[model samples]
Target: MLVEDEHSLHAINVGRRLLVQLIETCKELENIHRIYAYVESTNLDGIHFYTMMGFQRRETLPDYFPQRASLTPDAVKLVYEIGNDSSTEAIQTFPVTNQP
Candidate 1:
């Protein structure tokens, strides 16, 4: 969920909305029980956002990202488990944003 560099969209809950929609879609599938996200270690904001959206840190992955000139070398694995009572209740509490 990459947002543009524009500051105006930064606090508009765009990322949260997209993530909730993705989770909702994933919950409809029978085989998908968990959602995993690998966020670069240096990206604290990204980590915080995912955690706020109910993803728990599973582990720190060494050299998870490719050795690209612009990419971080390490990452943290986050997981959100579905088909659970707590997760479903938490997901339902997130405010739904209207599509433009």
Candidate 2:
């Protein structure tokens, strides 16, 4: 969910749509679930969006992603257990020909 709003205004909706598409697009990958990544806790909006998108907050890893612009001194990790739920079931149910 790498959303960049040069102005940081009136881009939430666009960011949301892009994020959704990003996830769905990755579904086309072969065995992509086994990948790993990291996210900072200060990303409040990201946390909200990921949570609503079914990504669960795994734990609050201190100093995970060093705080910036004020140095809060902590960060957190959120995990999205994708490709193994009702969500993926819908994708798998679709006809193979419809995938793109």
Candidate 3:
């Protein structure tokens, strides 16, 4: 559900901040231990972005997205585990080498 306009500037880390807030809210209110997202295999940029945000690729679901079948044959499932000891903490503290 987190999406930014393709034509907008992407160097501001807006998506990252929003995603972090959502994850924190989910942990606090929903008691959700993990967050999952499905991205079409054809979208290498999407996969890379999520991976940079600390999501790990779990597996590829064959023909997972029928709607995108014509454009992409499969979907990749990714997971972001949340907790005090979760590895995703690195996402918060990792230094941004380039500041816009």
Candidate 4:
């Protein structure tokens, strides 16, 4: 889920497309129920992006990245529950702009 900084892929909806495809593909599987990700607490932009993509904040994970010597070592857990009809319907209605 990493994109090169030089490319500026965010402006073109790359992340949105990837998440949509992932949800769509996972929805077809009977066992898949939710998609979750841990983002550094200091990463405000990352948090905003995921929230905008329909993920909800689950909890704050303390010492999530012990190896990293950062000011904010805690991580925020985000989850997108795809097991219910309402969640799927929300995904289907997400706005995605087609960029050439």
lDDT of 4 by residue, 1-100 (tens): 4433223776788777878898888789766677776777877777787899888988988876655443466778888888745433322222111112
Write one digit per residue (lDDT tens) for candidate 3, span 1-100.
6364343556777767777887787667534566777777777777787799888989987876545324565778887877645333322221111111
Task: Kindly list the per-residue Cα lDDT of model 1 for residues 2-96, writing each as its tens digit.
Answer: 44334467678776777899899878876566777777787777778779999998898888777766667788888788863443232222211
> Candidate 1: lDDT of 40?
73
For each candidate, the alpha-carbon lDDT, in order, equals: 0.67, 0.47, 0.63, 0.66
Better of 1 and 2 by lDDT: 1
Each prediction's RMSD to truth? 8.1, 10.8, 8.5, 8.1
**TM-score of every candidate relative to the true structure:** 0.72, 0.59, 0.69, 0.72
Query: Which runs in model 3 stand beyond 4 Å of their true positions?
Result: 2-5, 67-70, 84-100
Top of the candidates by lDDT: 1
Q: Return model 1's CA RMSD, one decimal.
A: 8.1
Show how many residue pairs clash in every candidate, following the order shown.
0, 0, 0, 0
Residue 36 deviation, candidate 4, in Å?
0.6
Off by over 4 Å in 1: 1-7, 84-100
> Judged by lDDT relative to the true structure, which candidate is superior, 1 or 4?
1
